[model samples]
Target: MDNSNSNSNSNNSHEGCYFNRLLEYTSDSVEFYPSFKNSTLFTAGTYQIEQGDTEYKERRKGRLYLFDIEKDNKVKELQSIDFNSGILDMKWTHHNNISQQYENDAPLLGVVMSRGELNVYRLNAADQEQGERRLELVCRNDVSLDPSILTLSLDWRTDNKEIVTSYSDGSLALFDVDGGAVTNRWIAHDYEAWICAYNYHNTSMVFSGGDDCKFKVWDTRTIEAEDGGRSNSSGATPIFTKRCDMGVTSIHCHPALENIVAVGSYDECVRIWDLRSMKQPLTQTDSLGGGVWRIKWSPSDNNHLVTACMGGGFHTLSSEDGTFTDLSIKSSYQGPHQSIAYGVDWSYTNSSSTDKQQYIGCCSFYDRCLSVWTP
Candidate 1:
């Protein structure tokens, strides 16, 4: 939603998107659905402009901003979609009873890009109408198998079919969101795998993180179909792997606690691993000064969790019932989020609001900030 100039009033339909735009670049990701009354936001961003000669490409295309979280929290922008490349992460997928999905389907938006596409948009929003909203385009799904890779992160597999992608080189793809298929492709990580997840309490269990400091676990069933799953140079060898303390980016798998994971690194700590009895970190968090790209868990509150921390900013982790024993760290209104704190989300309201109430939606990067922190 940037470079301003798209909405004439309403009525775009969805072809190349570009409707109701206005979000001017660099604010990497933020997602929250929480709407029965108040919450539905998506914010994505990217930029680069060079053109001609070497081309310098970084902004092939990107713009997805749809906000409306007003309940006194206030966000209200409401419409923009413009996709094609350079977005790098976005997930919403609905039908909450707790997301085993399928109440009839309806809401879905799972994107990842830079050029290695894997899209799926279609926000029925209870059958449109408000400003004649539109995002439509159910599947693009390329997943970049051969070489030209770029898709950074994704994770949807609660029953929304499947999606678990993360790649820059150091691959790991498995998408099949309604058969726009890429079934499985692998490499697992020796370099930039950023993050990959799907273990909303065991969706066959898969999780990864890396710039090559490793923290892995994969067993889609032990993935081995040979070439139909495609490109598997010995793909399934991580029923376990761990060596953190630096480059492990972020990973979150703890919807209602079953293996309970929450890792983040670049050495700025925040581990909470318990994957079948941990190897270390049952709790850790000392330096939240930077480097923890994102880790969010609390769609309905298991104990509460959220963190962005890129230049060290958004933080909140509480522990009690799910029992990590005693863990508490809170820095929610950090001076007003200066920069780098990539993205964060956790706002599914039923509104009993207490236990120090926290409702968040954040985004930042090179000062393209977007925030809404309700208490």
Candidate 2:
């Protein structure tokens, strides 16, 4: 059987591409769902960018606008939330099993404000009559060691009832919505914690990275309760910790594999580690120039990973060895004019169908745009 011919035919039916411009021209964020050919792109400040709304009114000045991308590259206004502070990061939770309880409800959208307040917003179309969406304060905790919350990450737990956040002050906290409290908190590192990712394959595992020149792993199951604590000789309580050498910029747990992690660092390399052995990385490679700012493992395949470098271009690395293939985004009306690549996501298409082909989605720093690439 001609596998190439078979693969090509399958991809053609599933693969689609489009772009949504952020309402604000700043370094904003974008997420896409290609099967729906719909996307959400928002910027810090906001105005309104509707068709023929105003000739040249700035839509990204007051509110963070969320627009939905339709079939014809047309963006529809979905919802808008005004913030006294700018928006940091936003993630939509996938309703794997939680949708059963809500019945006819939209997935929850988690947002981290510039002031370091993490808020969870449940999209409820059931109450269109209220004309007002409810903004539930899931859990609010101030993580200000220097009066600045550099970055925050929010990932849903396996139970989908709780979320994990990594603060700038080198702290990791897990918030339970049902309990209305932070169930666990640990000072996993000594510097700014830039990223935190929960391994869905291994629900009890949490991975974090930061400016402390280390990427540490913490087992959520080993979290110390309010009273069950014992201190070491130095009076430091033992926490489930494993450290890397350089300041870690980004981290992702292998989607399908258990306990395997990909950590990108300021050392311009990506390190793959195993939680079972904490001595050293299982594999390491210097594919990213300047520094590997962001790295992501393919959700569809555990052996494939992607990296975004600081000043250099992006690279697709093999999980077998640390070898990588460089990818260049075309500057044609879309991108590569952007300075650095910051965020990357994978879009799996034709879920109900048998096709398994998926494309990588990326957004960069300077020129605010989104690009999709496939092997």
Question: How many steric clashes between backbone atoms does each model show?
Answer: 3, 9
Which candidate comes out best when scored by TM-score? 2
Give all TM-scores, in the order shown.
Answer: 0.31, 0.68
TM-score of 2: 0.68
lDDT of each candidate versus the true structure: 0.69, 0.53
**Clashes by residue pair, model 2:** 45-60, 46-60, 46-61, 46-62, 47-59, 47-60, 48-59, 213-246, 213-247
Largest lDDT belongs to which candidate? 1
What is candidate 2's local distance difference test score? 0.53
